[model samples]
Target: MSDGLPMRVPAPGLPARVRIHEVGPRDGLQNEPGTVPTEVKAEFIRRLAGAGLGTVEATSFVHPKWVPQLADAERLYPLVSGLDVRLPVLVPNERGLERALALGAREVAVFASATESFSRANLNRTVDEALAMFEPVVARAKAEGLAVRGYLSMCFGDPWEGPVPLAQVVRVTRRLADLGCDELSLGDTIGVATPGHVTALLTALDEAGLPASRLAVHFHDTYGQALANTLAALQHGVTTVDASAGGLGGCPYAKSATGNLATEDLVWMLHGLGIETGVDLGRLTATSVWMAEELGRPSPSRTVRALSHKE
Candidate 1:
């Protein structure tokens, strides 16, 4: 309390360290109404890495027509590529993959949907069709010696489809894993998941031969259950968590989507639980606050607000 830090109480049966997959640059800015300048985005990535986020998603290679906010992926990646961290980019298909590969991206992620409705809405392809599209992208990335991550959105619920079945999620995840994805990020895209749902999904994944080691969790905060679902994931042995700085990003395709779990908030909880993330809390909070100013709004992260106001 004296140092303005949460009292550490190490949680039992939790990983001692969690790798936060910072998604602010790519996922966070994709839905922004205004264009964030390429230099500003490069600076954001620099600040995130300076704050000790080891794995930062630099940008996406999606067509500018689809995500104008990140249209400068070509420019942004070059600016931050020199930073000493793992920089991943999302590739929608072989074209996107080639764009990232041309820029020398070492790690690439492909986005998929666990529900038919989301698949059709987001990718303009059915669930099976979308997977077919990503098949070669993942294969090409792996063949090039690049690490591939599969992002499975709507694993918990879909805006159009309501509750997604456990079996449906497992099937998609298994196929992604089978397609040479090094890791799979299970996304509660609409922020509708609870602790119990998280537990059941993880258990099913485990039973289906997809262990927690190759899994990550991405939760939105539409219902304020992001942290609780995250805690459940930690208890279940999933170490990688996808978070956006300052609680940024929402699904532009999903009508009910909201901001993601903020990096500051997730860092606060992890540090409070005595889990090592290697992130400098003060520096990370400052980074978020700086980013909020760039975006012309206050940070939605409770921890960012609390810590910044305390100063």
Candidate 2:
């Protein structure tokens, strides 16, 4: 846990606390068409931390040509370095990793796709070729004492190749674990995953020796199944979940992909279920409202919409 936040002991059926890995700042803003000023981005991250999100993904170190929105990674990291939260940046390759380390980043995440079509489209390489690229990145980060997170995109279905096979997902997940990823985040990139798919994939991973504790679920709300898929993961003992504040992200590579599961929505459900998340829902909703103003739009979060009316 970042900043030594106390973790609750999970009960028999459900985890007492679920660590919400907030990715709004990085994954959320990366797909925006217009530029968000560096100062505004910094303040947004500060507000997220203030709302008690301990593990917030601050920015991506990908080259400016690929993700121009996060081109200020060097400038942005220093601004939030003093915060008592786990600020993880995304590193796509060794060069990306070098940039992050230069900024004194303590944790970084690498992404790969499960299908060849998406890999070719997103990373400009085949699935095997991308993993070959990530191998050294993960190994080097681990050697440098930085926590490394592995992201497997399109774990359930792909836009180009529909209905990805279960075997392929498990194979890629196990390979990431073998390559020394501290944790693997399974992504439903197009939001096509149902609860049954979530349960089966998780069960397959466990059978392959990659336990649920080493996994996190990243779901998109395109088909309105993000929350339901998340529930399936929770029932199967997955404790880490990836969500965006105000439902702020979409996939640039996969145009059909939509916003991520809203942080406010996830927190509301956890609180109702008597699960501990250490997040202040009122504060989270306020932050979302503030960010919506910055983006010049209303937040996509249902919880934010409903709560803003009361406020």
Candidate 3:
């Protein structure tokens, strides 16, 4: 592990290259107790792209009343719009989509939940109602020539309703896939998922005619299982993973939810397994460290701490 590099040992039954969907800029900063400065958010996105993250979620266009942290989406988008990497923003509805589209955005994502309680809590809509809401949004985005991603949260477990059924998750995700989302990002919102549970969900989706290649896994580290669950997804043929730099952000609405899988940690494991993610671990770790300083706290990522100290 010289110079913060992991020894490559290619694994069997794994994709040669995996895409890291960096979410720290948007999903990561939205949960901060205080709003991060717009300039800082812009710099973070640039640093992530510079670290070789091919796709970086830039910001969300939700109403400022809902997420004041990202209220500066309009001001923030312009600063990072010229970046060469893909910049995807989260759009909750047509208004959000309009705001993103006005800013020349080519990629947008819609966030949905798999459980009723979460749907009501997050979107004030039931599972069916939420999907109905997104139908037009996805269609409109696609019609406008934008790539759309569907984020299905609470796939594993929910705070109010314990342990979700596999069929329940599969059903919701299948609908999202049908909405013409280029990809579905399945979320373990409360971080209670185990490896077998991860395998079972992927299998169910496959049976439902939704293959793993069209899915991305978004795992939280509350139970310290994010990395293990991610490994299970990779073994199951999922190549796209959603991770936050410095392991920042949780479900602002889900009180029990925790920080997402750290990009630094995921890159370490992927590089170790000889998978290509086109990310520079040292630069990514340095970016997280810089962000930790801006947030006025040390990063929670072990790899960030380890590699950062060496630098």
Using alpha carbons, what is the TM-score of model 3?
A: 0.99
Q: What is the lDDT of candidate 3?
A: 0.95
Candidate 3 stretches greater than 4 Å from native: none
Q: What TM-score goes with each of the models? A: 0.98, 0.96, 0.99
Pick the winner on lDDT between candidates 2 and 3: 3
Candidate 2: tens digits of C-alpha lDDT, residues 1-311:
23212243434588888999999999999999998999999999999999999999999999999999999999999999999999999999999999999989999999999999999998999989999999999999999999999999999999888999999999998888889999999999999999999999999999999999999999999999999999899999999999999999988877877799999999888876778888988888989999999999999898889888864
Better of 1 and 2 by TM-score: 1
For candidate 3, the per-residue lDDT at 52 reads 98
Candidate 1, number of clashes: 0
List runs of model 1 lying over 4 Å from the truth: none
Q: Write the per-residue lDDT of candidate 3 for residues 82-189, one digit (tens) a residue.
A: 999999999999999999999999999999999999999999999999999999999999999999999999999999999999999999998998999999999999
Q: Which ten residues in a row have the lowest lDDT in candidate 1?
A: 1-10
* Candidate 1 global CA lDDT score: 0.93
